[model samples]
Target: MKVIKSNGEIEDFRADKLINSLIRSGASIEEAQEITNIIQLKITKPTPTRTIYRLAKNLLKRTNISSSMKYSLKKAMMRLGPSGYPFERFFAKIMQAYGFETEVDIVEEGRCINHEIDVLAFNKNTVVSVECKYHSSAFRASDAKVAMYVYSRFKDLEDKLKKKYHKKRYEGWLVTNTRLTIDAIKFSRCYSFKAMGWRYPEDGGLEKLIEKKKLYPITVLSIKQDSLQKLLKHELVMATDIIRISNEFLENLGLNQRKINQLKKQARALLG
Candidate 1:
């Protein structure tokens, strides 16, 4: 039976539409098909968003296999590898979901110069600087380097903004795929800063804050089925297919033009 729209049911799954979405997102037909197969197998329950989220996560991994069936899809994803700006995009989604007026890739003035904050939030008289990270494993001590850099940059940015807009209150936030380091956690607690990680909500640590609506927790992948339904209707993607082909096509045209110029030069020489 077809799922109905009013009852929050998923419409018929169309492999062709899924394939086209993947292609639009830059996946080849073969890769898109493989991802589709994996998604079909994994999404056994009735959730569309989790299906897309899981599919996106798995497809971003690098596959290593000599044969078609036994590849190890466990390698680390490089920066901006898939979903280009995935973490920033994810953080932006969370902020919007929570009713914050937000801007992605916002520039703020630091002590020395202008720095870019990944996501900037404005709520009444308050301004918030947000940093987002998506990784395969827990955050490391070294990863704090990025946190510090963002902090340093944002100081300048915030000062600049205060002057530019004459604001007196501002805040900061850091969002990561994994939980915070012990040191980072301690630092935030002492400073009254806001930070959120994947493990934070699972441990019931966020229940009070979430209940009070003081913190915006990342909504569970399981609960965002509506998001998935919306995603399915929106489009599918491979992450890198179209851009690669377009780049190659442009390069080939440039090469052909060069070769044609060489041929013309030789023809003129022969005529002389």
Candidate 2:
């Protein structure tokens, strides 16, 4: 059977790939095999990768809640938005957790134009103007056009900054919830712009960075939509934020001790 990848490329589907993914997410050998068997029996035609992911997640949820949660991390990131702003804020928090001072939604004057940066992250030596591209859907990717735009903006800023703010090196970055197109990756590399996405850079992509820093979004938890919205409305985004809050505060949210404990356990497991 053919499988449509997120980038819209069609390829032959391999059941072993599905099994390996499940095993990587902490499913046992037997459970992974069983899930793969079920999926093979059910899937008759070409399927989109997102549909397969959803099916796997559903099966995993029935077998192991923790594994299901783990598998859902990328989807949870996609859920961080009806708009890109929330994801930008979440990205800023992740940057902060990694020791970079960050500012969101800053309008800075470039050499010839004013640019609104999604996130500005800096420390002692490096300053990065970030363009955060968030997509509500998992299948969409940041393409070459995005790369070109961000690169132009970066060049303008770099030109302006060199004449004034000369001490710290300035850079540009494009971060996204989904993957980047091949052209996007090529352009970024050619221009010395850092492009980060769900799986870009292979080793240090957004997912790896989040895992390394133990900075997971609150949406990753298996919570009721109403409760999750309440937390989001209060600007509570991180799993660590939930852990840091007092028991009284959680009680005020109408969560029982049992539910709170479950959340805590899930959050901690995600961090590791």
Candidate 3:
């Protein structure tokens, strides 16, 4: 059977690939193989990759809830925004957790024009200007145009920094919640700009970075949508934010002790 990829391309379905993905999401090898077998039986026609993902998620939910939660990380990220602004804040928090001093939505005068940086991160040795591409749709990808634009903006800033701030070197990074187009990846590599997306770069993609840092968004917990929205409205985005919130505050929001404790447990698991 053929499967439609997230990029809208068609390819032959590979059961092994699906199994491997489940395994990466913390499923046991036996469970992964079992899920793949069931998926193969259920496929009647050309299926979208999203459908396959949903199927796997449902199966994982029945067998292993923890793995299902891990697999749904990207969906949680998508839930973070109707606009990209909230995602920028979440991204800055993630960077901060990793020991980088970060600033969001800062405007700086470049050599040619003033540039609005999405996230500016600096340690002692290096400064990075990040262009955060947040897409609500999982299938949509950041394209070469985005890469080119960010590269130009970073170049402008880098040139100015070299002339004035000669101590620290500047670099460009384009980060996305979904994925990048082939041309975007190629252009980034050719130009030496760091381009990272959901699964791009293989080892150091956004998902890998989040897992490595244990910096999960609060949306990953199994909570009611309205309650989650309330938390988001209060600017509580990360799972770690739950630690600071009082149980009484959650009770005032209509959560009982049982539900509140469950949410905290999920947050702790994701954070750890």
Candidate 4:
């Protein structure tokens, strides 16, 4: 059967693709297969990709709620938007979770001009100037222009960044919530700087890294808008943060006991 993609492209549907996605979202092989078989039986017409996504999500929820939440990882990343600042902060937290000292939304004095870096990550060996390209639309990607811009800023500040951070090795990096265009990957190869997105770098892409640390964003959980806004307002972005906060802290933020329990339950399921 054929399926309609979100970008309005019609293509043959592959059951294996759906199975793999389910497995990645934390489903066991048995569960993934079961769900895919059901979806295949249901799709007699050329259904939109979003409809398939919803159907899979619903089935996954029935099988495993935690996997259902994880299945929405890409969508949850987009929910951090309307403003890229949240992504910047969330990226910094991801860095910190991996033991890199990070700063977000900082201005650094480059040799030729001042540059605003989205995230500057420092380890014992290297300093990286990171630019985060956040797009609300899943189909949109970071193109060559983004790679060029980040590379230019890196060239201007490489020396200063190294000296200031006391790291001999330095890099200009592009990190996006979406995919990278082919030209963008090509441009990054030309300059030898890192340009990474959702599935880039094969083994260590953004989602892989996040799953490695269980550092999912708070937006991934099933929560009401008001509770989510309050969490964002308090600068608590990581799902694990819900695990760390005191009950009183959550109460002061206007979250009732039931809401608090729900957050903790999902957070533990994701992180533990």
Candidate with the greatest lDDT versus the true structure: 4
- lDDT values, one for every candidate: 0.48, 0.85, 0.86, 0.89
lDDT of 2 by residue, 189-212 (tens): 998889999878998899888767
Ranking by TM-score: 4, 3, 2, 1
Cα lDDT tens digits for candidate 1, 228-260 = 223222221111111223333423434344533
TM-score of 4: 0.95
In terms of lDDT, model 3 sits at 0.86
The positional error of residue 249 in candidate 2, measured at the CA in angstroms, is 3.8
Give the poorly placed runs of model 1, Cα more than 4 Å off: 1-84, 138-143, 201-272
What TM-score would each prediction reach against the true structure?
A: 0.44, 0.82, 0.86, 0.95
Top-TM-score structure, candidate number: 4
What CA RMSD would you report for each candidate?
A: 17.5, 3.3, 2.8, 1.4
lDDT of 3 by residue, 1-272 (tens): 88998778999999988998899788999999999999999898989998998999999989987778888888999988877877888888888877789989999889899999999988777787889999998878999999999999988898876665567788888999998999999999999999999987898888888888677788778877788778777778888888779999888878889999998887776555
Q: Please, what are the lDDT tens digits per residue for candidate 4 over residues 1-272? A: 88998779999999999999999999999999999899999899999978997999999999798899999998999888767888888999998888899988899999899999999998888888999999988888999898888889999998887788764589888999999999999999988998889989798889998888778998998777777777877778888888899999999989899989988998898777
Better of 2 and 4 by TM-score: 4
What root-mean-square deviation over C-alphas does model 4 reach?
1.4
